[model samples]
Target: MRVSAKSDYALRALIEMTNRTAERAVSAEELGRAQEVPSGFLQAILADLRRAGIVRSQRGQSGGWRLATEPTAVSVADVIRAVDGPLVSVYDMRPESVRYQASAEVLQHVWIAARVALREVFEEVTLAQLASGDLPDAVTARTAHEDAWQSH
Candidate 1:
C-alpha cells in the first residue's frame, strides 16, 4: 500500500508532539518547521487530526495544538486513518466491498489479505513507542531481516 504525504506528515507531527512538553501546545508553524512539512499542508493535516479527535487545539497567545489522548493510545494506523481514510481501498471502496468477476475474483481476497497484513503492523505501533525510539518486538523482528530493506 502507498503511504500518502498527508499520512506521513501527520505521523511526523504527532510524534514530534509526543516528544514535547504536553503542558504546552505546539503551534502549527513550529510543527511544520520541525517536521519539514509545508506550513499550509501541515495546517490542513492538523485540522484533519483535530476533526478525528486525535488532537485538540488551543487559542489566544498560547494557542497551539496538543494530543487529545495519550501517545500510547494513538496507533500509527489511527493517525493514517484520521488523515487519509481507510487503510486499504479499491476505487475509494473497502477491499471487502469491491467485487471482481471471473478469474479476477481472487483479487478481492488479495486486497483483503493485504489490509490484514498492514493492520498487523500499523495497528500494533503507537506514537509513544515511536517517540521513545522503542519499536514493538514484532516490528523490530520484521526489520531485522536484511531482505526487508531491499527495494524489489
Candidate 2:
C-alpha cells in the first residue's frame, strides 16, 4: 500500500493546478517549483496524468497544464492509479485474480479486506478535498486514533 514518489508528485502538481484560476494553465516549471519536485520528473508525471484523462496540456506562450475535470471529480485513488496502478496487490496481481489453495483460503479474504480498506479511504478522498484542506470526517476520525499515528 506504499505510495510511490511519482504518485506523490502528480498529486502535488494537481493541487498546484487546482489553486490556479480555472482558465489559467500552469507551467511544469511553476508546478515543480511550487511543489519542490524536479521539473523533468514533473513533466513525466504530467504526461501520465494527461494520458489518464486527469489533466490537459496546452502549447504556445499561454500553454501549460490544467486539470481535465474539476478537482472534486478526481479522487486520490484516481491519481495514484494513474501513476502506480492498483492500490493493493498480491505479488503484483489483483486480489481477485489470485488463486489460493485450501490452506491459504483465509489469505484471500485478508488481501481482499486490505484492498477494500485502502479503497475506502482513497476513493472517498478527492483532489479538491486535499487542496481545500477539508478532509472527510471518516478520514479524520480514522487518522485521529492514537494507533493510526504510531509506527507499527
What CA RMSD would you report for each candidate? 0.8, 1.1
Residues 7-120, model 2: lDDT tens digits: 999988898888784868889999999999999999999999999999999999999998999899999999999999999888899988999899998998999999899889
Q: Candidate 1, which segments miss by more than 4 Å at Cα?
A: none
Pairs that clash in candidate 2: none
Alpha-carbon deviation at 87 in model 2, angstroms: 1.0
Query: Ten residues in a row with the worst lDDT in model 2?
Result: 15-24
Whole-model lDDT values for every prediction: 0.94, 0.91
Off by over 4 Å in 2: none
Against the true structure, whose TM-score is highest?
1
- Candidate 2 Cα RMSD after full superposition onto the native fold (Å): 1.1
- Tell me how far the alpha carbon of residue 104 in candidate 1 is from the true structure, in angstroms, after superposition: 1.1
TM-score for each model? 0.98, 0.95
TM-score of 1: 0.98
